[model samples]
Target: MADEPVLPTLPKTPFNGLGSKRAWAQANAPPPPSVSTSSDPAVFSSDDDPALEAYESARRHKRRYVGTWYDQHLALSSDSVMGDDGSSTIVGSSPVVYRPQRRAKGAVRQQKRQFRKLDSGVYMGGQDSTDTEGDVPSPYTPKYFVSPAQLRVSPRSLPQVSEAESAARDKIKNCVEYGNQEVDLSGLGLNSISAETIAPIADIAPIPLVVKGVSFEQADPDIKVYLYNNHLKDFPLSLVNIEPLTFLTLRNNDLTEIPTCIGKLKNLKTLNLAQNKLKYLPAEIRRLMGDGGKLVMLHTASNPWWTAEKLSFQAVIEQSDPNPLIRTPVEFLDSNGQIYSRFRLPLSDADLAESTSSLELEVEHPSELEMPKEVSYAEGDHVRLLNPTGARSLFEYALKALTKLPEPELEEVDYWLGVDEGYPKGLRETLNLAADAHRSGGLTCSVCGRGMVVPLTRWVEFHKTAGTIRVDRESLVPFLKVGCSWKCVPARQVVPECEEKLPESDD
Candidate 1:
């Protein structure tokens, strides 16, 4: 605040045109210094120095390339430069004397850009004037790897042997070489056992024989065989040849049917047929049971024993007693000779009326009422007689009639009465003897317990029996019975003395 400072003002010019400031600056500039030939370091340098000449040459080249647009236009006016003598001037190493290419009218000029590729698959440079011409970079060849071919073989060229068969062969070889008494072939998944594989071990007691100078001892008389948990569909008949075999087990297999010849195994003491797909067994199986039978241990658990036919609720309720005091329906029998109506309660009068109203009573199908009479063997029925409807011959009739006679009278009549007319005396005597034998050892009827030379009716049924083993769940070991006869008689609980008890074990 001490007295306002006086500011210096800019000098003014009389001319105020656009170039007035530029002209004033040129006129007021400082004068150039005068040249001198003295060897002063700041003012002069040696003219003959190579470094000085190179620097001058570089400065002249930079000036020539950086010419203004007007200079470049004049230099590129024609394809060749014309001299004062009207002759073309040849271009030298100087770039300014060369004429530029002329573009067609309305054509655009594109700047060529040069790019350098690095080892890292990247472009590193911007647009430049580098020419990419006749040198084509040797067409970059890509590299890859190829694998060698593998050998192929056909299945027909190899031996036709399965893994199971190979294993079975190995087992048989070991048994023969070591004289094994017990041949355990369990869980080998064998679908079948060839005769050749089972024949050597099937002998009762093989004799000592010399093979390849090696004497082989006889096998044990009481050989055992175990074929459990396999894929056997039928009993191996080859095993029947093992006369002295005492123990045989075939548990947990896919056996659908066993051969009747299995009864020929008179010495077999233990047998296991559990957890198989057997729907029913042959009647000859009885020969393996009872007191006189050989089998002491018989396992038949976990089989899918067939179930009885189901009875409708209407049939059960209709057969029920109408009396209110009874409180339950009477025991009713079905075609299967079983009583399944015991579990259902007797319907009340009101409920019975309601159910009856819903039933179509006016219409009755004739086809339903008329049952099929031409009896044909059902599925799973194992027929013993080929001709179920064949008429009996006179000799067979006479033999059947003799079954009704008393034992003393039947013994007295040793020959057929009138049925042996045209046969020879020896044949007649043989027939007469057969008739007497049939009368003496005739089968009894299953229904009425009457002695029969030829049974009029026969059926197979699975009956429930107690087992030594315990099982989980409320399993229905149902021994259902079915009777097609009009007189419905349920199966009696009558166990014959022979089959009532299991045979005494030798152990």
Candidate 2:
């Protein structure tokens, strides 16, 4: 009778009509062990009990979640609308409280739909969905930089620096050097590098010098600067500091506007600004279009804002491309027997080879840019020279030279009369060079030591071949009304070649 164990009783709610199956299962469950057994809590009342060790081993040591769920009965206040569409959802603007209520089956659910009306039928959804497809951002608007900022590397997530960068840092310790005049750096365009900190070389070279982005504000007067593909928006004023820059490559950039200060680059010969987002040119930039009678070869074709008239006037040089002027006027060719697309001085094949070979050595290394204390000018150096204009600026000197020349003749010189009416072949060729120089830009007259003036040039025009620029004619231009004052520039005459007949084109 003592070994017959009593069964556990089932709860009243579980044994009710709808839950009787669950209650029956509980009623047939095994009975608890006798109170004195090791499994019973009564025997493990104190730590001294042997059963307490087993209980401690089975207990969980981790912290348990102690938070409560939002109450199912709670609600926010909201307004309702009756319409053809029998469904309702939650709206976010101006929330209102809703009371709990019993509803019949198949009734439209009265859930709130958070929405903002942007247009007639368009609504911006909230809470349950995102509102990313709205028309707030337009295409032309500057796209905000969406990448993470990297001012400095975190100590915990430091990236391994390649051995080459470390070696360049070692070699690039001193930025200032004067031996060969070059600044070459590679793999230094990363976040941690800066021009000032990396080296003291602020003097830019007139040749190719590849380095990381450097501060141009205090840069030296460099030329032939290649800054293409820099993803730039604003043209740096530092570039304005490069006073005598000749060949500047600003291709493939996001340039919107150019400053009038760009007119300062007086000696700039070739300006390559293809593939830019330019809308308009500054009026002062007209100084680049041979306005001051300075020869400026331009390549501004791909600019979106360039009009057809302006593009037609764009100048291309023979040194770069043979056919810079794609289209030719038939009248100009019809007048002369010329069949060439562009005007260029014919060079012997040996001379062409020499020029190409020199270009290869033009790219100077950064280590070679250390300037020498006494910079020596190369031989055969010929720049515009004046008699005695003391401490004059480059532009001022040029102005003085132009004004000092003699006035041209008043009578118009017929181009065809001199060539067809049996004038000396040597004289016709000389006039052609003078016309070329007058059209291109100024080259000082060898005799007068004066620069060419506009409308009526007093300085003699000369051949632009790889030899003598101007022969003779030296005087100061005093404001005078002049026209082709053909005081023929006296110089040694070149041997004339027989003119060839033009080959007819098929109509």
Candidate 3:
């Protein structure tokens, strides 16, 4: 067997000698020399050639950094790098730590002096130059870090107008005119002068002649004269001839009667006298006339006279031969003397005819009338005759006789029926037609003439126990029966037992 030799390992060092040797060789290597050829023209010559020199000079004049060594390797100048065009590329460089520059001794002293002035409360920077020496001291406390000479304001003074100037400013106080019309009352105590016044002040003007808590004893002649001539419902005339009267209103006055001498005033119009206590009107009030003899419009609603029976003030104005100038309340008087004030009252021909017929019937008949029953009555059936013709005629004669009798001796008709008072005139004709239909053979029973034999066409079987019998299209249920004396015994008399066992043929 043969033995082999091993290679030795190198010791580690801060710089590898192999790497250092390679780097040194690369740094010392010389650049390749340029070639020169005369036949290839001056563009191909080396730097030593004279023609190459001329070409190099021309190239240096025309050459640019476009795709050249400057574009690839040269760093941008600081002036170009800081330009605002934003196209300058920033190259990374090693960052150096920055240190602030030290201030000069004079500048440091000046800063220290300002801080000392501020700290000592000798600051003057914030105060106005024109501020007086006697002005209030600022409330700020100085700080140790600041100079006492540095001035700063704690509370500032605000500009303000003088009290005398503020008081002299003019403002609106009261109204002097309304709707551009002057309020005139020279004859009254009101001043004739015009001035601008507030609206509330203008509205508070006093009214004329307002008396409170006073009663009248036999109304004064002046008051009556003022009332009639001025068309006033109630006017107080303690001393009536007073002047400067333009408007008068006496609403809700408790005036029970009017004076006759009230037609004297010739200068009055537009009086209001609503809600008074007047029942009857004075005849002298009708004489209220103007310069052309036309009556003035009067307003007297809500008075007791409005609902009076005799001499309706409203009706008198409505039925006057010449319509007066007064505004009368329009009321439609019904047949019963009721008044309806609606503009379009519901009135029809049927209602008028019914009212007229009712009046005529009341006059002809003295008692009320009942409606006729649909059930037919047999002859001698002892039925109660409602509003019979004989009874009505007798009542009318008795009523006439009673009218002639003295009040003390006249006897009242105790047996008088109250059913005939409102019967119509043709009721007897209807009764006669009903009687004829009942008498016809179409509804006669062979066993008992009183018991009607209703035809099959007129019979309506309402139930097994109850049926409706019709005669001439009128139907009735027989609730009451009138027994014939020849067929049945009377209630007071009883037949023998043998008599009760009648044959079925006899039923």
Candidate 4:
């Protein structure tokens, strides 16, 4: 075989990487001829030329680009012409129709858009600054009718009362007389008392006191209210307004709970609350204890109480053994045999959801909606706050500021000293209302025993005793406990012997 002949090689071009051969050819091509700017119409109106005819036909089919507003107006007006036969015909090319790009998902029209300028030095397009069509009515009207009077809410009316209720109300209205030291309203078979039923007492003026079978005629005497053996389920919170009440009896009723407003009774001495269905006492009841308190006697016996065993059933626990022996109150047992209060609040998830829904309907603020939730424990079984953030409200802040002031300053401002003391008219009334909104100036921490306007840690404890108030040996009453901070609340776990003390012999 003959040896392969050597093939001639073509020189590489610098623009070879330009991709398309047409682009490279166009880059090396010469410029096109310029059009003749002639005034002769006969030179351009040659019908025999097919290239000119093809160009004209293409130009007629294609829309012309209108660069300016004036150009667009001129092209639109000149594109059509009236023929001799009284018929309209398109004479020139039509101007381009503007089509905007599709907007993004949530894109909104610009409120203040820039106006487009015309060739005649005038702004041509944009929305007007004012809403000119605001008063214009729609062409189509809605068929449904809604009355303006129907939208107006009427005042809520009181519930219908039965004949027994009417008789009880009339009796309660006339029970208290002027200068009378005692108001007996027991054995009425009344289920509840309203503000209207207790309104007549407010009209009684203070008169000279004259007691029978006694040598002394006092100028004034405090009132004693007796409502024993009634079917009252709730304590009459309206009685907190009565400043002169010294003695009160609500024994043998179906009272399940007492309001924290009971602490407002600064002048109350003896209170009989026996034979009721009370399982817990508000922490505000502590205000009625000690020498400063006027309450000398408090009867809280024969009520179904929340004991350790009862509370332990509502607790959440975790254990490795399947059949673990659950302890009462579910807290560590100390060497002294005293158990720390670490029981979960007896509130179910359904109850919490219902309460939250109700609050959402009634309350407007988000902070107000944050009602107390559940509590959890940390790694060492120490109680930790799951909800209820340590946030102070505006009212709490104001109350805290007023409490921090010195006694002399408080007195100088004519601040209402006690519940019996009349709140001074004007600016002091606001302070009085603010202070009364939170009875005894807010809550008291159980651990540190310090007054707090806003509690940082809130928990429930089944206590055996309520201050110095004596009860039956088997009774275990629930008490609401709070702390200024988590640090103040004691941990549940018992301290290990090693952590408590150093190794004695090894040392």
- Give lDDT per model, in order: 0.40, 0.31, 0.25, 0.45
- Model 3 lDDT tens row, 5-49: 643532322222322212223312231121111113322111222
lDDT by residue (461-483, candidate 1, tens digit) is 33323242222123222222212
The residue ranges of model 3 lying beyond 4 angstroms of the native Cα positions read 1-235, 243-246, 290-295, 306-320, 324-507
Better of 2 and 4 by lDDT: 4
State which candidate has the highest TM-score: 4
Q: Once model 1 is optimally superposed onto the true structure by TM-score, how far is the C-alpha of residue 132 displaced, in angstroms?
A: 70
Q: Residue-wise lDDT of candidate 2 within 253-276, one digit each (tens)?
A: 677656545656676666666677
What TM value does model 2 have?
0.24
TM-score winner, 1 or 4? 4
RMSD of each: 40.6, 27.7, 47.2, 29.3
Q: After superposition, how far is residue 376 of candidate 4 from its true place, in Å?
A: 5.1
